[model samples]
Target chain A: MGDKTVLYDAHMKLNAKMAPFAGFEMPIQYTSIKEEVIAVRENVGVFDVSHMGEFFAEGPEAIKFIDNMMTNDFMGADLYKAVYSPLCRENGTVIDDFIAYKIGTERVLICVNASNIDKDYSWFESHVTEFDCQLSNHSSNYSLLAIQGPRSEEVLKQIEIYPTGDFPYYSAKEIQAHGEKLIIARTGYTGEDGFELFCSNQFITTLWDKLLNAGVIPCGLAARDVLRLEVGYPLYGHEIHDDVTPLDSALKWTVKFSKNNFIGKEALENYTPKYRLVKLSLDKGIPREGYPILNEEHETIGKVCSGTMSIISGKGIALCHVEKAKFPKDKKLFIQIRKNIVPANYHTKPFITGGHK
Target chain B: MSNVPENLFYTVDHEWIKIDGDIATIGITDFAQKALGDIVFVELPDVGESYSVNDTFGVVESIKSVSDLLIPVAGEVLERNDDLEDTPELCNESPFDNAWMLKIKMTNAEDKSSLLDATKYTAHCEASH
Candidate 1:
């Protein structure tokens, strides 16, 4: 039995197939991965993502503290705006990638991956000596729910809590629902236009019930994985990890090299990527993580990082890191699937794109 | 509850088999298909292929993970399901009928003695769950 979220009982009542993820007992699926995925793509779906970690950095030097610690520059970000960044070690390897929302001049809220909560908190705590800021781990104090898809706005309207003012993309707003304080963010992981709600644990069950009653399909982690992969999003454990740098993981855009002296600035400036992450489309077999990526000569050049069959495209798509020097020339790649080597075509764009409305 | 037809024999690995004379038809049970979520790809053995009991003959790839299709009886494959190559989702929609993966001529008819009836198979699924 792992750590159960506040929505654990709600998931059980919905007949969710519970599985362990990042040391938390979470829902893997309710009815089926395909069904849930389609519902989110064509209609609306809700996901209980309360296992994600949340932390607060508050004080006078909060902006400076965040800008220096992450690879991205957060000092110039506007209030209520979110910035995506990869937290790197001194050696330029990624610790984790997270989103930082500038809630106020003296306060910034950071949302991080659940698996890296402990390490990230310690890393932040160890660096606050020079800054006049306080770092607090509020992971257990809040619950998160992501309402995603094309029809997400309709569901929010049905709940009667949709923000009235300018709630642009990647923006956060604090609102009240049913006399409870709730933080609503126009951000999501499924490459969909959606809102993520963060509220006290006591209020989450009610919010979940409201979303479900409003005809939002209950989705789980499996569907979320496929949805993100269809749009070429990187998962932490699959695409980026302690041994993989942002440059190698195709996340160099998140690293602002112009920033004055971040944690991995010097190392990242001199570092050359060993492997370059690229997308591939397969017509034969589904590619999986750690599958051998071969060249025309059948030589193992690299390995798949994140791969799945996109039900939307009806084909296999993958994000794999190939040796920078051994990258395919003719756009021909082969994924060694079980006993057969299946041919693939290299693609620069995502397999499917939608829900950005 | 999953559909477990009374006429078919079952294995502990969640495969359902139907025997007629010396020929045996094999497929994953409805319980197995439901557990696998959606079947995205299916790898079938070629006709005239031979296998022993419990041998991994093919593969079934779902949206979540891959599972090996195990042969329940020793036999030579007489026919293979060609429709699965184009539409693998039949495994989820009709696991017992159209999704029958292979038709093998049994080398030893006594293999049926080790299979379980529907009532016993239902008990096995309940206990495992």
Candidate 2:
């Protein structure tokens, strides 16, 4: 058995298929992954993302501490605007990728992957020797709900927590709902326009019930993974890992070299990437993780990191790390299914666009 | 509770078989389809292929995972369900009837004795979960 989230009973009541993910027994699907994916793309869906980790950093030196640890430029970032960045090792390889919200000038809230809470906290603590900052792990005290889709604003408007229309993308604010204080952020893993709500366990449960009563589809992690992959978003363990650097993961844009000094800056500046992440689509076979990707000569050149059949396009899509020199020039890629090699074509990412701003 | 039809014979691998003379129709049980979630693709064996008992003949792909289709009885594949190639959700929508995977001519009719009955299979499914 694994740790259960605050909404465990609610998921069980909905007959959700519970599975262990990142040390938490969370819901994988309530009805079906296909239906939930469709709901989020065409309509609206809600996900209990309470298992993710949250850390609060505050003090006079918080900004300096964050700038040293992160690769993104947060120097002139506005309050309530979240910045996506990667935490790297000394060798420029990724430790984890996260979103940081600058709630105040001297205070920031960092959302880490659920599985990396302990590791990330320890890393933060070890790096705070030079800076006078306080780090607090409030992961257990908060529950998150991601209300996502084209009609997400319609669902959020009914709650009246804040003026949903005024909140811009990648922004957050403190609001009150049901007489309870909550943090509402206009960000999500799904490519749909949505908000991620952070609040106390009791308040989260209440909000979940309210959203369900208002006709929001209750989605699970399976649909969430598919939705993110459809939009060419990277998951921590899948696309980026301890061995894969941000450069190889197509996240070089998140790394700003203009900063004076930061962790992994020297290594990243000197290192050259040999493998490039590419997207491939197949019409018949569904490619999966660890499947060997073959070049035009039928030689195994790389492996698939993440893959799925796009519910919107009905084509098998995968993200693979291939040798930079062999791709585009080779022009053709094939995924080796059990006995057959199915042909696939390299395509530009965000396979289906225009869903998110 | 998963739907386990009374007359069909079952395998420990969660495949169901219906016997008629020397012919046997085979497909994954409803319990298997539900466990696999929404089936998106089904790779069928060729109609003329011969397989021994317990041979992996094809595959069923779901959005989240893929499972191999194991043959329960020794037989020669007589016909394949080409319809499933286009609409694989038939396995989830109607596993017992419309999603029948293959029709086979049995090489050894006595192989049926090795399979489990509906009661035992239902108990097996419940126990495994």
Candidate 3:
């Protein structure tokens, strides 16, 4: 058993079937995963995402410090904007993936994977001596909620304090909900048009009730997994790891090579990756994580990172980590999925681009 | 009220077998389908394939996970379900009736005694949940 978030009791009250994830007990699904997924695609669905970790970097040198830590350009991007970037080791291997938000003067809010909170904090404290930024882990004091879907904006307007209703994707702003200031960001893991709320832990129940009363459906991790897979969003440990380089993980674009000296820059400069992440649609089997990937002739290539049945496509889909040499678009792979060798075709991900009229 | 015929034997793994004289018509329990949610694919063992008790006979692919439908008794597959190849959802829509996975030629009738009766199977499921 691990620590429970403030929303744990609320979820159990709603009859959410809880499962352990990142050491926290969270809801796997409140209802059928299909219905929850449909709710997000067509209407609005609220998710309790308190398990993700939040950290704050504030000081005179916070800007300069974070700019060197992450691969993506921070100061160059506009205010109220967020960028997905990988914090790398000096050898260019991604230590973790994170989202950086510029909230105010020399201050930035970073959301990291729940499992890496302590590790990331220690890393920052050890290596970040030159910069005057003070890093604080604020994960335990906050409750995270995601109101995601095409109609998320409409539902948001129902909340009295969110008057500046329109936020471009990847942007964030502060708003009040139930008299508590909340950090609202137009960012999501499901690749949908939505807002993520970082609010006080004590206010979760009121906020959840308010959203549900406003007709926003409540979803859980089951729908979250399927939704992320549909859009090919990578998970922290699933598709990448500390040993996985940005180029090898198909995240080369996330690494800004020309940026001033950062960890992992030297290793990345002369790095030659042998593998790349590729999306595959299995023609025969249900591809799953850890399933061995093979070339057409049954030669071992790589392994499946994530897989699921696509309700919208009526087909089996998967994201695989495969040797770049063997996973060209013209090549076919066999995913060994439990007593079956399902054929897979290398294809581009983001199977469904949301926010369409 | 849905067809859990009084005579059929049930396995905890959700497979049910109806013994017609000696041959057994095998399929998943209706309870299994509801729990699995949606069936997208079924990998039925080919006819003439023989298996021992607890052998992995085939696979049932659902919308979320793949389950290994095990063999309760040592037997040879007499016939495979052909309709499921085209309409996999039959397993979900009608697990007890239209979604029969295979017909098996029994190797030992005594092995059937180890399986649970309808009353016992339902009790087992209820307690597990």
By lDDT, the best candidate is 1
Better of 1 and 3 by TM-score: 1
What ordering of candidates by DockQ runs from best to worst?
A: 2, 1, 3
Name the lDDT value of residue B69 in candidate 3.
88
Ten-residue segment with the worst summed lDDT in candidate 3 chain A?
A: A159-168
The prediction achieving the highest TM-score against the true structure is 1
Backbone collisions counted per model: 0, 0, 5
Clashing pairs in 3: A89-A264, A90-A263, A90-A264, A91-A264, A92-A264
Which candidate do you rate higher for lDDT, 2 or 3?
2
Return whichever of 1 and 2 wins on lDDT. 1
Q: After superposing candidate 3, which stretches have Cα over 4 Å from the reference? A: A161-166, A327-329, B1-5
TM-score-wise, the better of 2 and 3 is: 2
* Candidate 2 deviant stretches above 4 angstroms: A163-165
Error of 1 at B104 (Å): 0.5
lDDT of 3 at A39: 93
- Ranked by lDDT, the better of candidates 1 and 3 is 1
lDDT of 2 by residue, A1-357 (tens): 899899999999999999999999999999999999999888899999899999988999887788889999876578778888999988899889888888778888889999999988888889988898898999999999999998888788886765444678898777777789888888999988888898998787788988999899999999998888888888888889989889998999999999998889999999888788888889898989999989877999888999998888888889888877666575688899888999987887587873765
Query: Considering only chain A, what is the TM-score of each predicted structure?
Result: 0.98, 0.97, 0.96
